[model samples]
Target: MMITKEQRSLYRSEGYMILPGVIPPAMLAMLREECSYYLGYYDCIMDSRGVQTENISHRGKRYFINNRYRLSSRLWQFIFSDLMAEVARATVGDEAWLMHEQWVVKGAEQGMKFAWHQDSGYVKWYNPTTQHKPYVTCWCTLDEVSEENGTVYLLPHSRGGTKSEIITHIKEDGTNDLIGYTGSDPGDPVVVPAGSIVAFDSFVFHRSGPNLTGNMRRIYLPQYSEKPLTRPDGKPWAMATPFLKDGKNIYNHAEDSAENWGPFPEDKNVVV
Candidate 1:
């Protein structure tokens, strides 16, 4: 989990870095299988075919709360395992806290497009200021991603830049909302074989395209933040859904500090 100096630069300038083969293949396979199982559960519970049918959006499909204990117990350790956390700490510095987990699955025929927007936009529903420190999103690829399979596309440094200032908000229609950015170029779509990990700034503008590959494209995105960087309104970090409480220790060590986490200037040389 040692990060190269180049990673630091890319994270600082582009707001993202792709670390391939960071997670083992076995764990990744299990994650995919378990996710599929959960999707079935979610579809069963939230299926919109009834009188008050649920209109689950492709982008909102991550809301399905599959069994947390089964999933978190194992994946949580894999995430905070010394190696993984070290990389996270280096880029984000100390005060990082486990934020939340999102399972993004797009079925071939039902796959949908996510409009380009900053992660912070959705985050603003609770936090509104730009003064807080940046948060990190560790997106783990469960299936091979490609142009046909709807790989994620990043807009370089879109977080701090004024170009393409699209924000995520709720429209009057009561649906997920999106704004457009006119001044930015689309960063290349990152295609990774299963087991690769991509870390990016929570503020970076990113979105996924349609899946024409005739298969499901699945990804596990877990967000984390350094301590003291509260939401804009000054709420605690635990307000985000799926957050664990202090000392609960439901999974992993469940506690971290600046000593165990901080920026590493040495490993930045390795190119992702």
Candidate 2:
């Protein structure tokens, strides 16, 4: 199995696990290439709009490019691969859906720090009444990450509180980041190789430091849910593309439809 018993135990209790350098070298290369392409695409879009900042993104500093997997010729290979299936089965369940995907990047010395908040905090902010099981975030690293390069810090359930529920987050004024944890405990820093995947529960509290090094820190984050997550109105909050059913991959490239993926929730406070 991809995840060991000890690793699974840690995840069950702490809500996060680091699978060190698990991605194949060739697959990692492909993900990095796709990330570069998408980063350029985001810049081009920003240039066309004649704006330095879009939503939470600040030009040349930080970026959150989301849900553009259809544009990449090879991204589906990783998204629907055996590696991801194993991860989904481990963290989510036998049935899984692609809830969201994004390239979260921090550029060189200007990369800003991300605030501490659960992944579910964003969902709760958008749809307060909606309830769903905790999903899994496969934080696939495209570069070796450390505290110096904006690596994520995770707060375990024991320290951060219960993992079964979402905490209401307060929006920070300037950056539009949502804050959930304000206590003194410094979360556990993740320092791992380029191809590692840090899988965490959606309810886990996490944050990152600013990039202090002279190189960009890149991470391709793909989230999966036990089932399609919906708003109180019953509309999908994000992409709910089917990946696995009954412990088997049911994704069909030919049948994929961006139209059916549903509209990404409109968050005026944050950019897509």
Candidate 3:
């Protein structure tokens, strides 16, 4: 799985590019089946009528994260595998590190909607110039996702996805409305086929619409950092996180596997 020059160019120019069939079908199928294992422990909030419910999600569509690393090691195997890391490194640079690995599940007919935002803002603990300036997040689809099923809607080839791009409420659960995107209109919906991989910069303005289709959209998200995991103030990271440091899985420490970990500093009140 080499990241072609064209792919690299597309990414740099558009801030994102979908690599069609980048993942082998067999691997994709296996991951799709295995995705259930990651979400098995958590239950979505439901109404008395047995219908899914959510405060922000209209009909209860939501994504769950496997923070405990309790699933089969195969998941980690595929994530940390050299083949995948190479793709990330192609864009983020040789020193690219896998900063995070998790499965994102959008259940069938669950109307899940992700607000428009950027990973840069979430990990603002790291200064822009000192830390990894530009990062890439690879989103591998385990299921065929289309506009009908709420594929991602994003703005491409722009200096978007930053705090400045968002002009609406800037709270923990802020709508994160883009500079010009009104409630009635967002961006364009992207159709992602199964086994496809979408790599986008952390600053790309992107969000997915509500899934109204009758199938789940399961995506494996692997975040890549171009440099050593360190905060703006010279504090180390990932060493205390559950990420793959330099392509090696380090899940042996208690603090490394702790839950409820966030990116903001202790004194910051940006969000939980």
Question: Highest lDDT, which number?
Answer: 2
**Backbone clash count for every predicted candidate, in the order shown:** 17, 0, 1
lDDT of 1 by residue, 1-272 (tens): 67898988888887888888777777787777777776776666555553222332433322324114233446555655565566566556643566555566777755665656566655554444545456777778888888788788887774447233425444323324343343456657998888888898766777677777667788876666665345455655432222223322223344432244343211100001
Q: Show the colliding residue pairs in model 3.
A: 61-110
Q: Rank the candidates by TM-score, best first.
A: 2, 1, 3
Compared with the true structure, all predictions reach lDDT values of 0.58, 0.87, 0.59
Which is superior by TM-score, 1 or 2?
Answer: 2
- How far off is residue 77 in model 1, in Å? 2.5
lDDT of 2 by residue, 55-170 (tens): 78888999998888877768999999999999999888899999888889999999999998888988889888868888999999999999999999999999999578899999
RMSD of each: 8.6, 2.1, 6.1
Model 2's lDDT to the true fold? Answer: 0.87
